[model samples]
Target: MYKLRELERIDLDRINKWRNDQNLIACLGAPYRYINEDVDHEWYEKYLHARNNSVRCAIVDDKQEEVVLGLISLLDINSINRSGVIHIMIGDNENRGKGIGTFAVNEMIKHAFYNLNLRRIELGVLENNLPAIRLYEKTGFVREGVKRESNYKNGKYVSMIIMAILREDYESMPSLRSENDE
Candidate 1:
């Protein structure tokens, strides 16, 4: 089983490794860039200062070692508008394709809709990232629109598909467990 927890100091090395993985970076909408330890530290510091507008969590293996398998976040949170953008990555290759990402995404959705009282959660996925697109669709995120060639990666541009789920969609879907169960 997997669980979500606050990102801790010990997770930095692993996160940095994932950030530098070219194969993984290609799948992300962000541009590929080398991230050194110092840069990672600076990013963490910024994350700490941006707590009011973000909710980042480490996805952990709960039944065994409690090892961090990935990270999930809700960024650019607008309390007045009750909306935010969500992102998730299963950094550990060995832990991928084992339902960890699904668990983390669901948990984050619950946190946004139930805990934070947010009505809409959105994300943008690389047009060619089929696996991620499928996962988001499975989680009730509908394709809102496409940004043509919005991101430049690997010497070429790629489109990004915007997806989002509103509070009504979450309430109508069957859940593995109720929000209050968390």
Candidate 2:
């Protein structure tokens, strides 16, 4: 089984390694840049310090002796609107296709809507990432719109599709449950 927990300092190296992986760089459309130890330290500090608009967590596979399989976060939170953008990364390449991403995402959505009292949770995925797009759709996030030619990556410009799930929609979805009540 897998569980979502607060990201800790000890996981920095693993996180950075995953962040700098070429597959993640290409699949997630990350900027072509190296993520070193210093960068990871700074990012961790900011992630923990930022109070108004951020929350990050590590996805742990408990069955695997608590190994961190991935990470996810809700960033750029708008309290007034009760919304935030979701970001997730399945760092373990071997575990990528095993539905861990969906599980982590669902956990984040539960926390956002139930604990954070968010009204909407949204995310953007590259149009060509059919697997991720399908996962998001399966999780009840609708394709709200598309930003044509938004991302210039991998020798070309690609469209970015925005997906979102509202509080009501989440509540109505059978697979999701409020974190507080759970």
Candidate 3:
């Protein structure tokens, strides 16, 4: 089984390693710079203590010892309006290109709409990253528009595609429906 939980201090080292990984970070839009353990610790401190609008979680294999797979977050949440922006990073290379992201996203969407009572969950994907864009599309996110040349990476600019899934759309997803339903 897979689960999402609070990112703890013990996972800090591994998260730092992935943050410095050239190939993995490249796909996730991270800067091509290395940070030391001091920075990692400081970053974790901020994450642990930071403010009110988000739910930050680490994806883990619950069948085991909850070994962390990656990170996922709901940012810029507006409680009054029931909306949040989603962000996911599969920091583990061994866990990439599999259906793990889609699975985690499905579960996150359920939690957001059902548990949190959120009406809309949105995300932005780099237009050039086909694998990621496909994952989002398959997970019930509909492309809203493009933020033209919104980010600069490697040597040039890249556009981002805005995509989202509303509570209504979530209810109709295949993964959200099953014969087992009562």
Model 3 TM-score on a 0 to 1 scale: 0.90
Q: Comparing 2 and 3 by lDDT, which wins?
A: 2
User: Which runs in model 2 stand beyond 4 Å of their true positions?
Assistant: 63-66, 176-182
Query: How accurate locally is residue 70 in candidate 1, as Cα lDDT from 0 to 100?
Result: 92
> Can you give the TM-score per candidate against the true fold?
0.94, 0.92, 0.90
Q: Estimate the Cα RMSD of every predicted model relative to the unseen true structure.
A: 2.2, 2.5, 1.8
- Candidate 1 backbone collisions, by pair: none
Shift in Å, residue 100, candidate 2: 0.7
Say which prediction, candidate 1 or candidate 3, comes out ahead on TM-score. 1
Question: Under the 3 Å rule for N, CA and C atoms, how many clashes does model 2 have?
Answer: 0
lDDT of 3 by residue, 69-148 (tens): 88888878899989998888888778988777887887788888988899999998888889998998888999999989
lDDT rank order: 1, 2, 3
lDDT of each: 0.90, 0.87, 0.83
lDDT of 1 by residue, 48-136 (tens): 99999999899987874458899999999999999999988889678878888888998999999999999999999999999899899
Off by over 4 Å in 1: 64-66, 176-182
